[model samples]
Target chain A: MKYISEYRDRQVIDRLAGQIASFRDTKAVFMEVCGTHTMSIHRFDIPSLLPAGLRLLSGPGCPVCVTPVGYMDHAIALARQGKHIIATFGDLVRVPGSTSTLEKARAEGADVRTVYSITEALELARTHPGRKVIFLAIGFETTAPATAAGVLQAQKEQLRNFCILSAHKVMPPALEMLASEGVKIDGYLCPGHVSVITGEEIYRFIPRKYGVGCVIAGFEPADILLAILLLLKQVTDGKPRVENAYKRAVRKEGNPKAREMMESVFRPVDTEWRGLGMVKKSGLVLREEFASMDAAGQIRVMVEPPVEPQGCICGQILKGIAAPSDCPLFGKMCHPGNPVGACMVSSEGTCQNAFKFQSDG
Target chain B: MDELIMMAHGSGGKKMHELIRNLFVKYFRNPFLESGGDAAVVPPEPGHIAFTTDSYVVDPLFFPGGDIGKLAVSGTINDLAVSGAAPRYISAGFIIEEGFPVKDLESVVRSMAGTAKQAGVQIVAGDTKVVNKGKCDRLFVNTSGVGIISEKHTHIATADHVKAGDQVIISGYVGDHGMAVLSQREGFPVKTGLKSDCTPLNDLIGKVLERFDHVHFMRDPTRGGVATALCELAEGRQFGVLIKEPAIPVREEVMGLSEMFGFDPLYVPCEGRVLIVADQSVSQGILHTLHGHPDGENAAVIGEITTGNWGKVVLETIAGGRRIIHMLTGEQLPRIC
Candidate 1:
């Protein structure tokens, strides 16, 4: 609370709001890459405090929202097999994969489980020596290290039953994908949790290569407001710099040990994103040295890269070009209770975020 | 051994003491447990004390907004705080499964320490019991609290004091704590990056209690969210309550998560936040004070207690349509605190 509470002061917000008001040139779009920032801005009515010219958009920082249809199809394949338990992070449990969710699979009597960490799945393999335990390793860099660590542990333990659905994604490639797609992102509010692991330098590539001003921001209202102010100044000055606005938690290089653990066990590969097509070096896979931990690659499961659902605009929503309301079935046809798209299934999904908060614009 | 919780662990046998010493007494060892008693006796406290006891067995011991430990402490303290009491003391009881991981138990206990430390309450007493894994879902924590109600403050517990013109103000966002717990517990991918807003609301209450004379009623919206809390205040009386959906501070994450899981935040649980119905004159003063506090930073004016559907909660939407804010039929996500 000490580190977090002081940063959310109201007096500072008042000062920052005035600063934001004075800085507006034209109605500009500032895209926050983290789902937390998106919610924080909406939670405290931070947008109302800002000048009407400052338009904030949510980008694809949500891992669950970006996970391709193919990955969910793969999970569905394993779940339908009923031979192994498909263990995954709690966040991935409700995401509507190509045909069904892990929860639906479980309801249909598939051996699906929700785990807090990859290690919980690893322990399951240890406990149930006979049954195959395939951990669904889906996340960005912040969570990839934990899955990689779990893989390393599995190989060391010689757990034959333990394997991983390696769908871990990286940030930079996706940012490149977003920028080159021409989404009109004036600036970026980078992810706090991922920056803690990848450091501030990972984002430097974005501004240097694509010319988008980026700010590594915290999740509080003040933090986001400060990041927006910094971005506005950068945009106004025609500067493209990756600034570390979350210095309290993030460092220049990030967590070295976490990087090393991921590097040692996993290698970057081309992986498909939900909205964006496959990008090279965007996903982490268990190295050849740790092939035994690779379930899909090892078992040689030919899971065709599944197609995105017919009407789901999750891809467009993820690109910040479209809101959840853009879809014909925002609340009418695709409510959270009965999701129609991947974006509608996850809380971090832009559509769901918009739907829940009712921010139609 | 894993099927049923055998009585040997609770029979005061070697296994019983081992279960106590190794597990229960291990995480919860305090002056009370160290005192060795059937029920620990209270020492002493200041004048006109307020004590409230609550047993939380909400399934999914861990939820999006909080776990049983956070709920246990916050729930107990909120009960006292709404009754015009300043929380000072607390006691906890954990009903754990036999094979419940010691580490998980420790994490919940550590969370309790965090909540207690923030609330300025001491864990004066506690007890632990281990049922079989099949008998219980990991853990369930029951907590009781004690607080000192200042003599100068009028009791704001009952709704009979709430007038037709009283203004209803809410601290922070609605359905945040509930959506967080539901999304996390159900593992819905709408990862809102929103953690449970579980904290002590005593600070906000202190600010309001210290200010004006017209502070009428207060309650922490927990299970069934603001709708149920409002309905409780509306029972028997014929006061109409109209709230604007746009006016309420609902986080996009809660909405997103609720949309993803088909949950209604109006029926979701809130932990660190509170709902206050006060005189129109004092509403601004209370909001200002709450905004100053860490826990109540997101406070907003949601609606008011008016005089038509006295028992029902009505929500006015952005489109000028009205919908009844009703009590929860079923938990959007079970086992969430």
Candidate 2:
């Protein structure tokens, strides 16, 4: 807890909050594009510390929140086929599909298991050779390299029963799409863990092209307050640049080995996002050489066309255009226990975070 | 006797009688159990009686600090202790899997006897049975406890008695039992040097009930940790609870593992911790008293009840932020997504 506990020092956080409070002059909207950042911001109640003019928006950062309904439907369909053992991260198990969730599928006797990492899924395949182990690979750059490594490890060990259903996404393309769509933004708080893998250089485009300040931030109260101060200073000075506020962990060049492994195993492909619909080259797919390890290509299962739940504005919520309370079904027909949208399902979802922390007016 | 438990041991024949007399009675020797009757007959106390039962089916029958036997005994005792009752007697039932090593059974029975003695309670009555190998885990224990609650303490420590301005005091650290079990079961690579906090709290609670007149609510943060206990105390109530994140004590090792696993320590389980709500006037006195005991050395006043955010639990974070702490819905599984 050395590095973690120090960043949570109350004295440092108060000083940084004061700095941020002093610099506020005009209405500015900043977005944090990582699920962990969004969760940490809400977990620490950072909004209450900010001045009145600055507004922080949660962007399409949660991989589970942004994953389209069809992909989950397909995964659920494969799980229901009774031939595959579906291994997935815990958050995805609760995310609702068009008709069913992985939790419901599991309760209905599907062979679904939750694993902490993709390597555990590969290990499951090694032990349970009689059944096919299909890993529901999902996340942004922070987790993609691990999945890629899992695939390479599986191939090296020649594990025939191991495969992955890739729903991996990249952050830069989604940010570009957010900027191109004229979403109001003055700066960006880039994801710390993702930047650690892809390097801070990947986020320089936002500062250069859109003239928006981008600060890669760590997931601590002081770290976030410092990042906000940096962004506000850039706005006040009429200058925009890529700044690193999480220098303790993230590096300028990122982890070269992880990037190399990710690039070697997967390729960028145009994929659909839940709210931002069909962002070009925003997702990663398994390479053709590793096609046999792709669960989508290896399994032949028919799934119905994905259908959105009626009156669920998760799309708008993920895009940061709508608040969770703005939805008609929020806290009425939809809740964490019986969620109708992805935003109400995962713990990192904006709606879930808002519902848990925000006061009801 | 066979080296391991067999089907004949459950047949209520000569083998069953000898096993009971040799193993059960040998360790759990007491005047009440010596009667060798189907029921324990004791004089009624001059107060209300508290009765509770629990079953333990924990995997890896043995854990870092305690096993299923100790867990079953301490768990039942803690339930009664937190209710402002002094536990007196307990009945144990054991279901042994066939082919289980007799040595392990003896060890479990010894652990149960040791825990019950430490709690100042007697295993007055008992039953034993054997099942097929796969029908049950290696061993399972079911315990029912009986305690005596005085007239004054009968209704003083219920959640309904809680009101605004009451202070919430948590005894010791949280998440030790949960992380210990998870690490042992999953073989986590992280070396946490952590052990389960699974001791009986009857003595600790007894000292407080004897000296305190302002106790409002008392609960052990067992399965869902402090967060769930606070939520239960606030649910459908007229008051809300606000806690300080920095005020809650969590071991550095547990904190490190929680961070690595994407888990919140508040939602993890703790077997030997209690959350006590008392009047704010005596909160400091209660903290001082709790800190004097070994089990409550790390105790602190974590939060207070308020009229705002009724029926909810909010945490004032270390950095001057606030968020609602909800009851855990499902398992606190790791998040890689």
Give the best candidate by DockQ.
2
Model 1, position A358, has a per-residue lDDT of: 44
lDDT of 2: 0.89
True contacts kept of 1: 0.00
For model 1, the local distance difference test gives 0.76
Across the candidates, what are chain A's individual TM-scores? 0.94, 0.98
Residue-wise C-alpha lDDT for candidate 2, range B54-123, written one tens digit per residue: 8888777788898888888999999999998999999999999999998898888899899999989999
Docking class of 1: incorrect
Range of the 10 consecutive residues with the lowest summed lDDT in candidate 1 chain A: A352-361
Pairs that collide in candidate 2 are: none
Candidates in order have lDDT scores of: 0.76, 0.89
Off by over 4 Å in 1: A300-307, A359-361, B1-164, B168-222, B227-333
Model 2's DockQ score: 0.55
